[model samples]
Target chain A: MPSPADKTARPTGFRVALRDARGHLDPHWWLVAPILILVVCLYLLPLGNVLLLSVSDPKPGLDNYERIATASGPLKVLLTTLRLCAITTVISIVLGFCVAFAMAHVRETHQRILVVAVLVPLWISVLIRAFSWLVLLRDQGPVNDWLMQSGAIDQPLALVRNELGVVIGMVHYLIPYAVLPIFAVMRGIDQRLLFASRSLGAGAVTTFLKVYLPLTLPGVFAATVIVFVFGLGFYVTPAILGGGRVVMLAESVSVAILQTVRWGFGAAQSVVLLVLTLVLIGIMAKTVGLKKGFG
Target chain B: MTDESAGQDIRLYGLSKYYGDFRALDDVNLHVAAGEFLTLLGPSGSGKSTLLMALAGFVEPTHGDIFVGGSSITALAPEKRDFGVVFQGYALFPHMTVAGNVGYPLKVRGLGKPEIAAKVRDALDLVQLGHLATRLPKQLSGGQQQRVALARALVFSPKMLLLDEPMGALDKKLRHDLQLELRQLHRRLGRTFVNVTHDQEEAMAMSDRIAIMRAGKIEQLGAPRALYDAPETRFVADFLGKSNFIEGKVTGIDAGIATLDTADGPVVHALGTRPAGIGDSLLLALRPQKLMLGPGPNSRKATVETAIFLGTHAEVSLRCASGLALALNLGIENAQALPAEGTTVELGWDPAATVAVRPD
Candidate 1:
């Protein structure tokens, strides 16, 4: 028989469980809880609701998902989206790596200028940046003007209002994101390690390959993921620069939702995009592990 | 790995390093024999580490040439120079297992998988870390981490070995243990080692010869006992170890020994090598152990200011009328019956005990 005080007090087992839970949860749950809840409320819940609406509309059936699987238009849009993002990720990562390497090795004054040049565009409106690229890369724009004036070409090359213009604009926008991560990793890399490698009998190129490249692989992976994921959801850049001729998934989804009023179909397309992004992230996380990939 | 007998002689010619207007090293010249353990010992700002870095090809000298085996290697990169370096921080790659860290050079050299594994095993065994090859650097204690670093540095038998305060981060006892191990390893390998350390005792214990540096220049370079007995300047005397400076004026010179009139009283002392003139100011560096801590014919009366009982010996600080504070060590037997504090005591030294050095 337990005493009155013992009966009223929390059980030892339950108390221990509570303490263990608090120990695990206290650090992140308090600080990150608000943001996590916000993501659930604003992002996850809406996405989940879209999933439900895609299947449950009119009747609980798989019609919307069937459209995704069988419909040529959605399938085409998905393929185009993947192809464009792949190309953009490749271009952005290569260019960003060069720019980041230059930034890391340059004089402090030059580095400041380069940093501002990359980051200042990020703070500007994305729509405005896309418009600015249109203004620059259009057939009669400054680039073609210079090319024609320099007698490099007899006429303006096809530079704008197509996949080319869309890619150019997207790469321009994604360059900053790609550059920042690669640069951060490049900066953290022990410069001595490179010297150490070279001193140990490796030539410049070999040292770069063995030491610099492997060390910066994590950063490259991160940049690729960021550029690819961001490219998947991009709307404004594609709309303004692709000139309504090129059809990316976001544009197709918009048409399905707003023009055709196929809300279920649009939701299914969005769900597919989100799932694809998650799948890619999961693969990256699996291969590199979370720590190195995010480092 | 090449046999230790193939080690090359290292020579540096007029090596100098400067950071804009600040000179970190100036006109440094040094020669290390094929299998000698030479140490560059100095205080923090004395350019000892810089000299080691210059030789290792990690720090490019602003001017001068370095040669290995009589061939100029001024343009050789550190790795290409084939010199092993144990960095001051140990610099074990935290991501690597102990075996992985030790096997890096061989791996980089594109050794076959089986060869690499065998070499890694051999290297770990050399450092007595074969059982702990799977452990990461972070899992090991500081002393163990340092041993792993040593194993990594010695994994490939390089042309020479450079250590920059390799045991600086260890505790005294650990440092002592590792110092003996290093000395033994050096003997076994028979490869020239250029070690940089600020700890004079460590330098004295391990170096075949020690180069004492001050203000970006070597003040004295000689055998450890030679340096201890015959320092060239006051700075070299003070920096190497503890010394009681007795400023005096040379009163006479006879039979290659200088008699000086010291402030503590008249003292006749031998000038080991250099000769001094009459009325010239002479500075004598008296080692604490040299002074006798009792009444003698050549003794000066001193008041016992403080006494500290060191484990092996007792250090007694005495103040004389000349306001010179002197430290004298008393062995345990003598320390057992030490004069009480505030009591007057007589301290003296033999004529050959003190070294006459030029004030810098």
Candidate 2:
């Protein structure tokens, strides 16, 4: 990379006066300096304090971190979180891909309606959505009643207060996240590529697999990063749906903080979630960037 | 690209495609001979592209039977039709490399990797883009991307190649160059090509025959020179090129020559004898180049209105005594000599140059 001074070597190029500005700060930074400072003080300070407490409180050291790595309790919570998030990501991506694909090809007014329908759920609070799912999936709910009345099931099935109920609520909450990104990408794809593929003697299935699917990988990768990260930090949905039976990472962190009052351990778990989400995004960004250009 | 696939003759019987009440292609019938390069030439909404798409099996005709090599393919799927289509916008797979795109048809045909790679190399070489095989479509220039599309379409050597405005996005120089290259390739491959374009110059220069369409119907179909020389209708003459309409009444008919009395004076149309009688009003389609400056069999006294110097020729506007305006393409030699605006001069042409047509 060229040095900053070299880049601004021509006076007309930048005229930043890097040396004269306060410790290399551009004069333009002054306009947003107050807001930037406030963001750091209010937002980053709390986040940094959380990380600091993970190692400082209760005699400090790596006690909370060691427990996260070695103890079965923290490990089990992490495992459950990872497993459920993976399942939710997969299901949401598959279902959202279908919705987005349909939206991409439909008529203009119909596509508008579909886009609103997909995004409207996000406006509804996750708490309300989770309760709705709980009501629908629990024993003696309408679904179970219908199944029993149809003679399909002898009794109400175990649907709520478990992993299944939690996944249902999380997938519902995460679906819009999956759909919007994928839909945006799918809409930009030229429909003629499909026709061109077909005319080149590739069948519909082959064209979808080879041309359409590859073109959509960037969107899928972005959705996976979003749905998975959002699934990790999800608090209310899992709490309401899990009913204290299927404890996940966020729920465990809440217990350690509010009930057991282990702020250090909770903060440690929070840092773990932050690191995991960042690492996933980092990995996804590489592949997404590689396939991002499609014009 | 292959000896086994020379070309296939295509026949469309009473093809009609209707969207609600709008007729995209109304009662169209056409026969393209084997190994012929035919162009469907028309302006937008004239259904030229629609006809090409129908042949490619992308657009199904509401009522028609399309036969290729004497076998009906009206119900065949686009993939099953085995036609190489170079779509408008090229539609190169952005995710795939150039070589991958060119190899796609062969890959779908289950060709071995070695054979596919070799053939892709040859196809790229055919378009003279072998070195850019590994680059993605977005990385190439527009003309390069167009060449890649051509390579991919011709890679598998399908029975025919369909191009929908293949040069629609190109500039004039590149379009002319590609037109020449495409024509040479057609001769080399001996494959039937059905191209759709609104550019009349492209149609005239590259096509073995041109099918001029208007309002979902073929206005005229013939070889380029034949169509230009003897357009059957005013629309054909106007759309294919610029034409000056002259109204006249047939005053005499003798010895296969018809003398018409125009407002300017008497003129003769000795090209050929047509269905005409004395005192019959007629419309003549006279091309700009056909209108000469010297006296000839058909002569008209006119005053020059304007003369604009173009590279090859100067386009002069003339208003005859009848107040009928005509455009003339004067050669550079005459353009350099003289004749200022409003200068009165006698404009003449061979009687054969004036083609009689219906007033429409």
Candidate 3:
């Protein structure tokens, strides 16, 4: 739906047609050029600055990158970040599959209600959700008090300010991301396929494993990539729920730059996170093989 | 063609399905013999698919029992019933290749890898899709996908096969081709097939017997020729094919023929399986092709209202002197040709040309 002025502005001359795309740019480039310029000025230049600072600010060479493997503290932070992100992604995808399956099968009215329930938490501030979890899950919280009153446990359980709390907060924040893509895939699946599988002599479990599971795998893969990448950069939820005990990569980067004034180290950690996320996406994209699902 | 398991006779006794107040399937009692191909032909909401689903065990009837070879299977699950159902959309697993789709039943049966591979190859070859074994379902054409669905349904060698509008999605030429292939496959397999469709022509072409349903009830059940020539009800007469009805009252009886007094004239109707009494009031159902433009035992002087050329025949619409409208087809042999519109023409037919049907 381009304007008539836009249509007339295109180079429709024979000279332009003779030249290939390398010189005779298509009109589509006009729309993209502004966004490209904005991204370069607002995002890429800052990212380049970080890259430059990471290598040059602290005595040059591979000193900062080398410390990731050499130093135990930063190495543990990296390990903890990977571990929490993985756990959160796995938990979110499993729960999201169930939620999405229900949403896909239910009547339209019920499905809409369930969708709103899943989405409401996403629209709420992450800081609020994290605090709510913190308030409910703390050692002296109502959960522990109820369990103790019910004679299930004599002592309170440590639920927050740990790796478990960070994982819980991250998974809660990411379930919406997981559910949407999986639900999109599930909605495209014809219910007759399940009936066909059963008619083919496959029982419920076998049909699910062979037919239903494979059909929804693309959505699962998409959710996994999405949730994992989004989880990698989490700052507020982990900071509030972790209670400063658990150190994710983003928190570590913030500490280096703002608190410790170690800009080079912060830039190095950002670079590491970016490179790792891109690498993981590359591996997953290959495994996902875009041509297969939703065809 | 494998003799390990042959077709079994399926019986539905007092089968009925009620959705709240609407009856999806009324008390339907049917017995399909071994190796017989029966079709449930009806319009939407007439319960044809509902009956087929009940037989497949996907739908549980409100009160009835389904038996295969004298054993009741009313309470059995769809998977346990051991019946293959070809869905309307083919429902080929998009994630699986053609070979994978056909071999799924065998795999679910716990067959070994090599055995499943060999059987899959045979099934693909049966459908003439051996070259496209590794291709996904979406890669193939509609006809190829349909054949793949048929192959997958037959690969398990089930006791019975149920098809729900197998050719509903194909174009005219494709539907015609697949109809021939399906008939041949049914012959080769020799399995009792219960197909469901609203297409009268498809049912008439493929089915050995058709159960025409209406309003969740079986209006009539018989061979295609028997149903067309001698329908018991007006619905059946009109549904099976095009038919012209003349509202008449029986006035006389002679041998098998019954004379009915109509506004146009006294028309003679040949009594069928359900004979009409002398004083009974019933409608006469006449085939369009049977009525000719000439004088006969039962004749009507009519004005030609309209004439449409239909390749091999011309369909003539007539308005009789008594204001009775009628339609008839004149074959190519009618060298007299169609009379001009608004012109007078004499229409006639023999006693055996029309059947007396109960008004529905």
Candidate 4:
């Protein structure tokens, strides 16, 4: 019924066009596809299920998210979690900068020793580190025993079962995580740049501030975002070190799911945490660039 | 020739540099006059760059002092020494625009915004790069970037300018063009420029005087013409240009010219400063271009081994004896009657054309 040109154009042209489009796609797209499918099934689908449950469980409505904004205690919990994560991120990034700078220029033998020290903490279980901190900082524990022995204090100090203890444990764990990315960036920087600056008449401190600091800012931004995101979803360190006293969003979500038997409320809290992490990450990606931000 | 206006006296006294057990520079001593362009010419690993680095304060000499204008600068830092350095790779800041890179030294010196802008504009204009002031280093061509480096080095109008193989990265034609331009610029600026290069032609064309160095020592140092005409050693003669070496014994001396008995014949050499007794073995350096080919007055008979016809001239390789060979250039005017290969021809040169040089 059709002419030969029209008949060829119908299927063969479409087939060639599709083939060209497929060729234009990145060669590594196949490797990326399986991971993307896994993430959608294991992470994205579950997250979407939580969002649906937060609104539709028991009844199809936005009642649970509404309660988050309206209820006084839930709003306070959200604010506390945000504030704690911000503080922990700042503290860890500062400590990480010093450690990374030291590692970047240290002798090879000493650098190996320092690397082992940092990685040793990473390999130790998070629960074990929290327990160790609790033992050291608890009232009438070794810290109080030392202070009483030194006669600096008349009574035991309140060190554990509080936000201070929780922040301390969190920073200790997150600092090594922050150091690696920043150190990688610092090490790759050309040392001649500093020499060039000095040759151009800049003093040592000025050269460090003007040339060295600006180049490493991307690494700092990356470390900050990563540490903050990891801190947001932390549970064990806060639970064990906070001694069930200071409540964070993750610990609160666990209570809602287990103790209150309110799956809707727990899912709502999780979805909020996930949304907050994504928002921070999005802003970071746009500012410092995606590769350096993740690096 | 000495000029009274040239007073930027640079003195290096017993300067030596050692890299552990290996000596990079021996006890090197040199004096450069003001407003003179002196080139440290040598092959790689010959310590020419090391001498320039020492002068620029990038390298610390192990055993001596560097004096600029009769004041020692050994303890001074590079910036404090106030000598501008143009590196081999140009080393322009990749992130900065042309104007920004040129203005960096001014900005570091705490110059005002308007002053830096004006100076940067003038410096770029001097190098004919005013139009590309806003482009980044990577955006410009290699020649353009090299010009930027030169402008950056000269922007501050320092007492001395140190250039370490500044034209090493350039293409041949570009390098030739830039060489003439650079010599003109040097004459106009009248600043002391101490350049390091292994390119012999570049040194011949650019330097007011060249210091030919080998094995961490100065083999010869003189004006370009003086060095070419009266090279004191075999290394200097071979390094400055092509030369046909004829080894023999000094048989006679009349006035300052000495005559040597060689395989080809008795070759007379102009002995300007060197003195040699009779029976002393000598090696004479005869320049190829100085040898006039074809039969004429003062011509010697030789058999042509190879003849290459160049555009302007032809190079004829002739054998004088069993093991002696001489290269002679025949101008295009004489190329019409060029001798065929294996043909005998007469090659001629003036009586005082060659110089007696010390064997390496």
Q: What is every candidate's alpha-carbon RMSD to the true fold?
A: 4.8, 4.0, 4.4, 6.1
Model 1 / residue B189 / CA error / Å: 2.0
TM-score of each: 0.88, 0.91, 0.90, 0.80
- How would you encode candidate 1's per-residue C-alpha lDDT over A23-111 as one tens digit per residue? 44333246668998999999888988999978886468888888777889777778878888999999999999999999999999999
lDDT of 4 by residue, B295-344 (tens): 55446788999999998988889888646888887788886677899988
Q: Which stretches of candidate 4 lie over 4 Å from their true place?
A: A1-44, A67-74, A103-161, A246-261, A279-288, A292-295, B1-8, B243-272, B284-354
The DockQ-derived docking category for candidate 1 is: acceptable
lDDT score of residue B233 within candidate 4: 94
The collision pairs in model 3 are: none
Model 2 over residues B154-205: C-alpha lDDT tens digits?
9988899999999999999999999999999999999999999999999999
Q: Which segments of model 3 are wrong by more than 4 Å?
A: A1-40, A58-63, A281-295, B1-5, B272-274, B301-306, B319-325, B335-344
> Candidate 4: how many backbone clashes?
1
> How good is chain A of candidate 1, measured by TM-score?
0.85
lDDT string for model 3 (B16-68, tens) is 99999999998998989899899999999999999988888788899989999
| Candidate 1 pairs with clashing backbones | A199-B78, A199-B79, A199-B80, A200-B79, A201-B79
lDDT by residue (A1-295, candidate 3, tens digit) is: 7555554454554334433444555555676789999999999999999999998877787788888767998999999888899999999999999999999999999999999999998789998999999999999999999999999999998889988889888998999889998998899888899999999999999989999999898889988888898999999988998989999999999999999998888889999999989987786678875443222
Q: Compared with the true structure, what per-residue lDDT tens digits does model 4 show for residues A79-140?
A: 87888889999999999999989999999999898888877999999999999999999987
Q: Which consecutive 10 residues in model 4 chain B have the weakest lDDT in total?
A: B1-10
Worst 10 residues of 3 chain A by lDDT: A13-22
